[model samples]
Target: MKNVLIISGHPDLQNSIANKTILDEVATALPNAKIRKLDELYPNFNIDVASEQAELLNADVIVWQFPLSWYSMPALMKKWLDDVFLHGFSHGSTAKLGGKKLIVSFTTGAPAVAYQHDAVMKHTVDEFCYQFETTAILCGLDLQPIVYTNGVSYSARQTAEQIAGQKDLAKEHAKRLITAIQAA
Candidate 1:
């Protein structure tokens, strides 16, 4: 069995509903997969570079799960990338992380309609995923089709029914993500 490493980039997963549900479902589905919760692991923003690199090296598949922040990954996850994916390790020289499968999975606050060409955001989520594509290419990782769930925001949803509905959506999102990971 190939080792699967799931990196949870949600800054504070405990405070989340959709994201937390997604991760919980994923963990249950892929029992052997290592899900690293960034918030719990590094609350002070000081990342253990060596440990993170070691996790990367041991994985055949890497899944990045987070709530989309400013059209990109959260600040903590970004810092992790900066501090861990260094030259001679991830990109240059040894290229230790080469050939690993990378899955970018995230949830967004906005609805699907808002991501269209003529919508409020003015571009699709895939367009915003260019940075992830670049990262995959630079690291020599095989990037998979992204798993994105739209309109799962708690702020946009205010009722008990709405929250429950989003939770159900999150479960479906997890199933879709699991299928994608299995295929990859």
Candidate 2:
């Protein structure tokens, strides 16, 4: 089994009913994987840079799960990257993160329609996540297509429908990530 590391970065996890459910499914499907909630791990926002870097370096597949905040990651999570993913460690000719597979699983407060180029949100999820994708590339990692779901406050029926929609996307993406890691 792959040594998958799932890092969940939601700021308000207690109210994250839907994303948590998806994570549960992912954990069930990938039983041997290691799941870490960053918020829970570094509650005081004092991330151990070396430890986090080591985890990333050791992981065969790294999944970034979070709620989209201002079109990017949560503040502390962004700081986590800034602190741990250093120049020589995560992005250099011999970066430690090279050759690993990176996958982003995200949820948003706005509706899916709002994330369209012609809509108010003004960009597709892929477009919004470009910074992370490019960073993965700089680290020589494979940046898989993102899995995005919208409307965090959706009703029960809506949440189920949205999750079903997201499940297909997540399943396919997860397969690619696992296959890439295995092939490596």
Candidate 3:
């Protein structure tokens, strides 16, 4: 199996139910995987470009794991991408990330039905993730099918049953992520 690198972009993992559970499940299922929690590493949003690039170079499969915020990734994740995926390293002649696989795994508060054309959100989850596809193309990285968990927080009040269900859903999502990485 290729070495997998999970770049977690949850702004506050301690308060998260879905994202944290998924990350834990992935770590347990794939013991050799390297999981990097961006919030913990760069709380000030000051990314260490050189160190991040080095991590990217060492991994064969890169997984961007986070909770969907405002239909996209959190601010720190965007900053990490902007800071670390530089012209030379990720796109230009000096690019070294080619052929590496990228998997986008996330949890969404909105249900899957909400992402449909007739739904309130009016756009599929994949449609919202087009930018990641373009980024993979530009970086010459192989794009893998996304693994996501939806309806994680659709209700404001979470009952014991609902919380348990969310945990189970997260575990399933993590399994799907593992499968995607192994395929990569």
Worst 10 residues of 1 by lDDT: 152-161
Local accuracy of candidate 2 as per-residue lDDT tens digits, 72-125: 999878888889888888887667888888887777777778889999988887
Give the C-alpha miss distance for residue 91 in model 3, angstroms.
0.6
Q: Native-vs-model 3 lDDT?
A: 0.91
RMSD of each: 0.8, 3.6, 1.2
Q: Which stretches of candidate 3 lie over 4 Å from their true place?
A: 154-157
What ranking emerges by lDDT with the best candidate at the front?
A: 1, 3, 2
Cα deviation of 98 in candidate 2 (Å)?
Answer: 0.6
Backbone clashes for every candidate come to 0, 0, 0
**How high is the CA lDDT of each candidate model?**
0.94, 0.75, 0.91
The TM-score that candidate 3 achieves is 0.96
| Top lDDT prediction, candidate number | 1
Q: Evaluate model 1: give its TM-score.
A: 0.98
**Top-down TM-score ranking:** 1, 3, 2
Per-residue CA lDDT of candidate 3, range 1-184, in tens? 6888999999988888889999998888889999999999999999999999999999999999998999989999999999999999999998999999999999999889999999999899989999889999999999999888889984732788888898888888888888888888
> Which ranges of candidate 1 are over 4 A from the true structure?
none
